[model samples]
Target chain A: MSTVLEMLSTPLFQRALLAALVVGISAPVVGTFLVQRRLSLLGDGIGHVALTGVALGWLVGAATGAARADAYAIPGAVLASIAGAVVIEAVRARGRTSGDLALALLFYGGIAGGVVLIGLAGGTNANLMSYLFGSLATVSSADLVATLVMSGVILAVGVGLRSALFAVSQDEEFARSTGLPVTVLNIAVAVVAALTVTVSMRVVGLLLVSALMIVPVAASQLVARSFRQTMTIAMVIGGLACVGGLLVTFTVDLAPGALIVVIAIAIYAGTAALRPLWHRAARPASTSEEARADATDDPATHRAR
Target chain B: MQLADPGSDPDPLHLHGVSVAVAGTTLLEDVSLRVHPGEAVALLGANGSGKSTLIRAALGQVPVVSGDAKLYDVSTRHHAARVAWPRIGYVPQRLSAASGVPATVLEVVLTGLLGRNRWWLRRADREQALAALEELGVADLAHRPFGILSGGQAQRVVIARALVRRPDLLILDEPLAGVDLLTQFSFAALLGRLHAEGRTIVVVLHELGPFAELLDRAVVLRAGRVIHDGDLPRDHAHPHGAHDHLHVEHALPSEPPTQRSLP
Candidate 1:
């Protein structure tokens, strides 16, 4: 507790904590929509594209000698992601392309582009490993601000895209006939997904950012009854994973991103395995007891079960 | 002003050489029909006769292979197709779809008010949705989750979604199938009322015998082509006691026409 409090007071540590909390919330909210739309792969693909942004950022910033690192690194990455989004849309409009194919194409293309660019800009004083695989041990205040701002943008867009997303996923034709802008809705979702993936890089490595966005929600789904319930559970689980990962990382001097992902997987496994067992363990002794209670006219217990 | 075409009041929907082929098979071929305002036309066809495809085409929801489907005199390709939708309400056959979707009757109905013209809906949207529910006599079920509603109840709610738009045309696809006789009569009465108000209604029905008298005209299809298009065959086609369904208290016995019956 004392160590945790001390870490909380330090500006860098505080920044990491804020970033973790915000990312935890934003990931699950956006993730729920993706899962509902059966676009979980799309999230993964976009998260992968976001990696190109990170690589692009480092390449540009390192070449510029860190004079305008923030502007070069962050904005360049975001713009690249937006461009990737546009290209994805354009490809989809051309022929027998699907969202899934488009996503995979952009993600792989981003990765290839990013790696080539990073390799071409070779001389790096900063550790490329840290950006590629994340080092929460030294998350900066600026990185935290970037995460928060991006998460906020993702959240705002998610809220606006709620109905549009729902309509498109469930019934595209009805949505179109009812005047819902299906194309615009799809583009908006892609943009937000890209933003979310871009911002979450500090807590989850470029290779693993999608897992951070997807795993908690997937794990939370084991015990959740409804989409909304799943979203809430995902957020809670994600935040807990972040907090626990941070504590474990700072204490044991481990890589926070990798540790957090392991914890997320563990949570997913535990929830999936234990929820049914817990329900079975908690059930009443006999069906006769439930029958007796119902006979007596007290309906609340029956309702509770 | 935009959902309705300004150039011509010819009919709500005019399809000419409208054919749609999915993958390789021709689903709808050279189908031409006109649905005039204040008219109630029953679309009669056997299964795979392009009944569903026809309904979808009229709403500009399906791709036309060769010809044009004009929704209020505007081709589906026109930018006004988006604007044309709000003025025409479409209730698809199945409300039992999206069984996992969590929405209340009121929430689903409120969706009708959404169109490209409006960014967001206000209290007026809810009010209109509510009024549509009231008109359909399903306002009491507004708070219930749509997934949990009875088929009859859900069908009414879906109809309300179309009716709430207050469009120039109302298109329903196989609405009466699986619905109770009482509910069917009530629904048909609502359509009768809409037709009386000068709104065009085109309904796709597999079983047309029960409500034969309710509709003013019908276009029967045989393998993606219109075989018959005229006033109902009123001259003792069945005399099967099906037409007097509203006066009876029992379920309306309905079986498809012999030629169109499933093999």
Candidate 2:
């Protein structure tokens, strides 16, 4: 308890905690739509693609002899992931390349590109390891600011266009018929997903970012009765796991990103185990009410008029 | 029922020599269909006969290779023409309303009222969605996950989503495919009421069961071509059969061969 209180007063811990919380809130916002579209691994693909962007920034900085080449990493990642997302969405929409094939191309090509580019920039693999596995203690104030702004934008788009996105993700044909601009919305989802991958890369690292995006939502879905409820509960779970994981790291020697993901998975496993019991407890009242309603009004007779 | 002259009011849906080809294979060849307001028409054919493709082309979902599809005289191919999308309600073929994520019946129904410019939904939207569920006799199930519902229940919820907007034109693809007999009868009655209220309806059906009395015309397709486009064919196999007998024989000998040719 003393250590946690002391760590809270330190600037480094505060920055890391703030970044984690922002990522916690934003990752699942776009993740909900991705899950609905059955593109759960899209974040993982985008994360791999963002690695190439990070390497490109490093290479460009080395080429120009900039004092701090690492400063350009986040911007490069934002651009590259967005580009990768658009290309993937186009390929999927055109039906030229199969969906899984496109994702595989992204996953393999992105990591290879990053490794090759980092080598060209004269950077050791050790420097890239921090991004691959996440180094939360190294999160600078500028990185924190970028995380806040990007997450703010993601939340605005994710929540503001919830219904339209839901419509398109749920039923593309029906959404298109309603003139919801299905193509534009599809592209938006991909772009937002890309942004989420990059924003979370610094906190949870590129490899484990998808875990944060997906596990919390999966955990919440076990008990949630509606889409809105699921999103809300998932966001709460994500936030808790992130803050809790970061706090735990203060007391122990552990990687915050891995710890956060482990905690999230634990929550999901616990929820899955408890689900049958939860349903068993809640089912009787609702079923009996449904039975009583069924007795009073026959569905056929009510619909006949 | 009075049949309005085609030259007077613009049709709800008009396809002019529309030909759709997907991946080098033609699905609809010079298929021209006009659905007038208040007319209930059925697009009937056996499996893989282009009945679904033709309607998809009319709705601008499938790109037409050589012709035009218009909604209220505005070409659907031209986005600048401003198609009145809000006035048209479409229920696609038997796709599960359930998605990868669980959505409530009300959430799915509320999506019907969403448009490109509309982002947030109001409290009134929820009420409207619930009212649609109420009309479908599934108001009590509005909060239930749509994925867990039975096929018939899910079908009713989907139909309710389509009807929530009170569209002037309703296009449904294979609405009764997996539905139970009881739900089908009730659906037919509901469609009859909607038709009586003067809304145009285009339904794709494999067989005309309870909807036989409701449909004004039947356009039958065979091998991506319109083989019959006139009155609903009488079931010659069962002259004294029940009114609800399934009529699956769409290729009637009475249809003129001249109507079968592509322009």
Candidate 3:
């Protein structure tokens, strides 16, 4: 308890916890749409692409003799991630390149470009390790501010345009038929997902950022009865995982990002194991008519089993 | 604002020699169809005959290779000449309402009210969505996750989603493809009520089983060309067999020669 209190007293720990909380809450916001659209790995692709941007930022800063070259990394990551997201969406939309091939291109191109740029900038691969694995100790005040602002924007769009985004993600053809700006809304989802990757990169790092986005949502779906519930519960689970993981790191010698993702996975496993019991407990509340309807009319349920 | 009189209104759906080709193969060839106000038209054909593609082309979902398609005199080809989508409700083919994320039946129905230039749904929107569900007899399932419902229930919810907007023209594709006979009858009766209320409907069907009595006109397509266009083709086998058979074979001959193309 004293150790936790002491950890909280330090400004570094405070900034890290704040960033984690912001990333935790916002990653799942954009993630709900991505998971719905079946583009759950899009954040990972954007993360790889952002690495190039981070390296480019470092190169430019070092060339200009800036006092802190790493400060420019976030802006660079944001631009590169957005660019990567748009390009990926365009490629997928055109249908010329297969979806997996496009993602492969993004994953390879992004990491390669980052490595090459970092070498050109006269920095060893070691300098990139912190960004890859995440170093909460190095999180600065400016990083926290950027994380907060970007997360705020993401939460607004994710929640405010829930209906439109939900329609588009659930059925693109029907959404387009309704004369919703399908293309614009699709791009908006991709852009928001990209922003989420960059926002979370400082806390969970690039490689594992998608875990923060996807695992919490997956955990929530095991018991959530509706999309609204899935989103709300996922946010709660994500925030808890982040805070819990950070606190554990203060007591144990472990990587915060890895610990956070492990906790989320544990929650998912727990949910899966308990889902049948949960369903059984809720089953008796239904009337006899609903029970008979399920037995005879609901082929989908039987097929699922 | 235009008057509410139906007689003076433009055709709800109009296609002028619209041809759509995906890849090297043509899906719809020079298809011209006009659905007048309050008319229930059905597009009928065998699989790969392009009934779905024709409707998709008319709605400007697929880019037309030549000619034009319009909704209420506004061209679908141009983005600036936007169609008043609020006046048209569309239900796609038997796509599973289930996605990676779970959605309540009410939430799915509420999406029908979206894209009408509104960012936020009002409390009234929830009531309106519930009313649509209630009309479809699936009001009890409004709070249930859409992914878990039976096919028939899901179909009703989807129809409710389409009807929530009170669209003048309802376009449904293969609404009864995979449902039980009882559900099909109920669907037919529901559509009959909507038709009696004077809504224009354009539906795509594999066979006009229960909907035969509801549809006023049938446009038959074969190999991407309109082979027959006029009154519903009489089923010689079951001339008076309305709602008697659970399944009805296509009235037209199955294997019409490929050379017989309409000019």
Candidate 4:
């Protein structure tokens, strides 16, 4: 505990910890919307797209060598994210039912493109592994700032457009009749989600990105009773996993991003295992007056627990 | 299904000389119908009767070739503030409340307010949302996550969400199509109450016996044209009243909404 406190005082440790916390909190919050929309795999879809963005970013900067990587990182990522989002949107517009297929195609295709680009640049899979799983120890203060700013914007969008977003998700035609500007808003949401995925890629790596984006949220929804409460709980769980991952990574010598995701999945498994007990214990006796309240309020017992 | 005789009269939403051809087949031909504001209407026909096609064209949610549905006082040529959108609140047949929709019952209802006001939902928004929920008898479900609600609850929430803005026109496509008898009756009661408030409701009615008492007027679509528009049987039980209004030449086929049945 003292060493953990000691680590917190260090600049490098503080930066990694903050980055993890920020990413952790933001992913699950956004994940709730994605999960509700049945687009949990879409995060994986965008994660692969971000890989292509990174390759493209690397390719563009490599003309002058690797020295310029930091300078071109965000712009390249942003441009690629926009392109990837447009492709997904086009497929959806064309009435493609399997968003997962589209995502898989995009993911594998982008990865191939990335691998080819790396080969052309004389880079190897070993060099790219850092981008795959992430390097939390290498997080600079600027990365922390970027994560904080992006997370703040994403969270703000979640709060302000909460109802409008929900209206679209629930009954899109009704939302249209209510004048929701569904097309524009839908596009904007995709772009924002793409952006969030792009930023998150740096923390969890392109491969494990969806776990961060989805699992924490899925776990929290299992526990939370309300929509708002679910989002809050997801954030808490995500933040905890990130902090715990960072602490573990520092203590033992494991990859920080992978450990973070590992911790998140463990949390999910833990919650699932404990749900039967919590669910049963939470149930009120049928003969009691409290049973009526338990029927609605205690949702754990509401489903087939 | 009704067909336009292709002569004499063209209803307000008339499809005069209009033949929509897609993939080398004609979908609708010379369809015409008049629908006025504050008129409780019905579009009745069997499946594939082009009822949905007509509704889409009338609302201008889709483009009609060689024909137009003109809202009174608005030119059909220019884009105007999402015309026919704010004027009508529509509820489609299916709504996905699948896992992960981040809205509550009250939040969904609040969306109805987005059209008339730009400000965030203040106290008045909450009050109106509550009132709409109360009108539907599901005010207690206001905070429930929308996706978690039962089918009956979802139906009532959709109705409440539609009525939140006090819309001039309400359009429901197959509102009672799949619901059970009990829920259907409750939905029928909601329609009656809305009609009492002087709001126009357009419901696509396939099963007429259940809703005959509450229907103010109906515009039957056969193929894509109005086959009947005039007094329908206001009371199914009696059917033999002196002033039944069913005999009128221009009386639409819907029952008079204002009249009460034999007690």
- lDDT of candidate 1 over A33-130, digit per residue (tens): 66655556665565556556766776777777787543465576677766776666556544444655766767888767666766666634243465
DockQ of each: 0.18, 0.34, 0.37, 0.24
Give the candidates in order of lDDT, highest first: 3, 2, 1, 4
Q: Give the per-residue Cα lDDT of candidate 2 at B84.
A: 82
lDDT of 3 by residue, B1-263 (tens): 13246798899999899889988789988988889998999898877999999888877888689989899888888742378888889998857547889888899988888874764678899999999999888887788788877656778888999999898889999897666566777889989988888888999987787888898999989899998888898982232345335344333322222222222
Tens-place lDDT per residue, model 3, A98-193, is 777878988999999999998998787887888887877778888788889999989989998888888888888887778788889889988999
lDDT over C-alpha atoms for residue A277 of model 1 = 89
For model 2, the superposed segments whose C-alpha errors exceed 4 Å read A285-305, B1-9, B236-263
Candidate 3 i-RMS: 8.9
Misplaced by over 4 Å in model 1 are: A56-80, A83-117, A123-133, A215-244, A252-254, A258-305, B1-10, B21-26, B93-101, B123-154, B177-186, B233-263
Better of 1 and 4 by TM-score: 4
All candidates: TM-score: 0.76, 0.91, 0.92, 0.83
Question: Model 3 segments beyond 4 Å from truth?
Answer: A285-305, B1-3, B236-263
Query: What does candidate 1's lDDT look like per residue over B3-122, in tens digits?
Result: 333245767888888998877789889999988766788887667888899888766766788888887777874454444777778888756464333456776777777777654657
Error of 3 at B251 (Å): 14
User: What class would a CAPRI assessor give candidate 3's docking?
Assistant: acceptable
2 or 4: which has the higher DockQ? 2
Stronger candidate by lDDT (2 vs 3): 3
